[model samples]
Target: MKYQLYFDESNKLDQPNGGYSYYGAYGANASVINDITSNVISIYDSLNTKSEMHFREYKDDKHIKKYFRTLNYVLNQNVNINIFIVNNEDAKNTAVKMNVDLTELRKLFYVKIPERLFYGITRYLQSGTDVEIFVDSSDEYEKLGLYTKLKEQMNAHSAYRNKCYKVHAAIPLDSKISIPLQIIDTLMGIVVFLMEKAYKTASSTSKIKSDLIYRLLIEGTNIQFFQKQITLYKWEGNEEQISEIPVSQYITEFLVYKTQYDLQEMGKFREIMLRNPHLDAKEYRKLIEYPNARLRMLQGYFDEITTGDRNISIR
Candidate 1:
């Protein structure tokens, strides 16, 4: 079997860990990847502008619609989304207890987290499958020897080696340039935001995000993975409390996250949009910035996007 895994990490280890740092991969059979991507890309074709799908950049209702459409399509395919989360408080405490500096301890995690995620993700893969890895562009991946270490560790693991699972070294690709990278970016971004509990606040951003997540939980999306696909690690220092949790528990949290706000608003949004597919965006912009004051987003949203250009969201 030939497989491709697009990998992404949410926050840099060099930065002080906030709620947590995320490492995850979106995997699928190499054969179906093109079909999946083409279907997703077509969803964005009707819009006036082209922008990479990114969850962090999602602020308004338009972003919500784009993501809802993408998720509606991608989740039905034969794919797996696996994640490993590190408890920042546990990491910070371990740094102090082990007589190691905080910065030094974090440098180790840049490698350890990816190694763990890869192992967990491979458990469900068929034996003899060869996986090609692609990571989001980051200078630290090269400087810290991440690619070599991952390849060596995977190829040398006794279980995987016996199974004939050949793992390739990762190549860094800019998310802006790779639609595959964009898929994992938005998926991971949603996970990290939920982990950060960003929706706990009363801010407008939080409400919009809640609505998006609510859509994810809709019946057919399959956003909730089976136990075989997702692995959640608490990374506790204590011998007893340290253990990996299942997707069941993670979904338990998601259920709670959705309950923080009433769903009537989201229900109305979906119902109206389904009735008048083209009317939503038109009505949304009526309450807007003055025509003279609004300008192009200071980024490119042209016919062609190039490697050197930053992302543009011209509304």
Candidate 2:
């Protein structure tokens, strides 16, 4: 069997308080790529816009609706997205504690992005497969010989001794002209944006994003399909420390990591938006007079998340 995996990384390591960003990839059987790409281009054809299909640029109404359709279509396809999130704050703290420079610390795990993501897919299958990798173009990858290293590491990986999975090609392709990269870019955007709590603010763009999240995750039984195709791994401590800590301590640490998502910032945002929901409830009731649908979506979503009706940590 043969498979094709497309890769992208959304790592916000420089942000001191920015909690988590993901590094991962999504792809499918090699034969499926062309068809998927063609289908996505046709989706763009309907919109008649040559604008990029990335996540951060989804501020327009028509474009976002088309984005919703594209998202639904891609999620329903035969593919899997494997992600690993790095907690920036925790990672920096770990670097200091270990007496290693941050750059040196990153070198310890940077290569594992491909190795770990590959294992995530291969272990689920009953048989070994030949694989080719396509990463969004980056000079950094070329300098590091990431593709070559991936080939060597995957072919020799012990877990695949029986399965015999092979890594044939690991090359970078420009996302500007690649639909698969752009599509995955959108997917990456949604995950990163929500994790960063970018949807909590009072803005038209925030509302648009919240609506998309609602449609993709909270509405009906969407998460069932989502959970099936997406595997999210949140990484904080180094691999060595994982064994040193007790299971109870690990669980406690994870719970703290998950809940400690920029709480102080969120508090300030709440105060800026409205300290009391009840006080804003009457205003929201009157906002029907405002006649802007997207803002309403944003306000309602903000209310849902604020009131605990919807959790931001949907993964």
Candidate 3:
């Protein structure tokens, strides 16, 4: 039987104030985790005498990205890693419910992406499997009172659902796991946490929030996706000269264009116009008033760009 393994981490929100801003996690098979750990340790042992492996020693994003990419190339060979990030809003809500005031709990909140990631992965696996979770124990465990509460909530839900997956927290980094695996896990936790912080600090309004979510999704999926779809469009043969287009602009445009294209292809434009009179009026006017295909496309794009059309858009 294959076992599911979940990993997570958290980062401060207010970097200057030492307040954390993000958290995230990934879930995969247990054997994959073991294999990843073994390989990572072997690499580290081989390189230890020549150079030391230090994740916490670096605070620069460029350095961190380089280190993580190297680790990903190694560990990802065996583990299928699915990453998720939690923004500041969600983190604040969790803290509020746990009675930890963000103003007063800065230090206690350092590197919490793991705990949040654990919660997310466990909830997802509630009805899917029987497995145990492992975590790197915090020196100040009492500060993470919210994590304990979330565990209790999961336990109650599991009992009601009659599921048997048990969440067991352990300090694998402090255990017999290979040094490389421990470092990789720690780096994963840090990256997820930073991504979350970037999401929250990027925007507050629903539109901007949706934009940020899409941006993170694109980045987490792979940086190349963003470069190809949003960034490298014109360079890659797109006749549309949108050199100054921001990532958010591309996301909104892509969604609107895709929806309109889909509706046209499915022969649903007429039906949609009939169902929504305003949409019909706009489309009819565009066809009659704007004879230019480019003008019509722009008008249609703006009209279709609603807050609810995209899944990443926040309510």
Model 3 worst lDDT window (10 residues): 229-238
**Per-residue lDDT of model 1, residues 1-315, tens digit only:** 888878877765457547676777778888878888887778778554478888877766556546766765676667777777766677778888888875677667655655567665666677788878887777777777767766666666625447567777677888886888888888777767666677778666665666566556543535554334455665665544536766565455766766544444334444554665554233522322212111121111110122222122321
TM-score of 1: 0.75
Better of 2 and 3 by TM-score: 2
- Estimate the TM-score for candidate 3: 0.42
| Residue-pair clashes per candidate | 0, 0, 12
lDDT of 1 at 106: 65
Candidate 2 Cα RMSD after full superposition onto the native fold (Å): 8.2
Q: Which sequence of candidate numbers ranks them by TM-score, best first?
A: 1, 2, 3
- Could you tell me the lDDT of residue 45 within candidate 2? 89
- lDDT score of residue 236 within candidate 1: 61
List model 3 lDDT by residue over 54-152, tens digit each.
Answer: 444333222222343344444334333333333455446656777887644444443332333344345545355655544445454445553454445
On a 0 to 100 scale, what is the lDDT of residue 306 in model 2?
A: 70
Show the lowest summed lDDT stretch of 10 residues, model 2.
Answer: 242-251
lDDT of each: 0.63, 0.64, 0.40
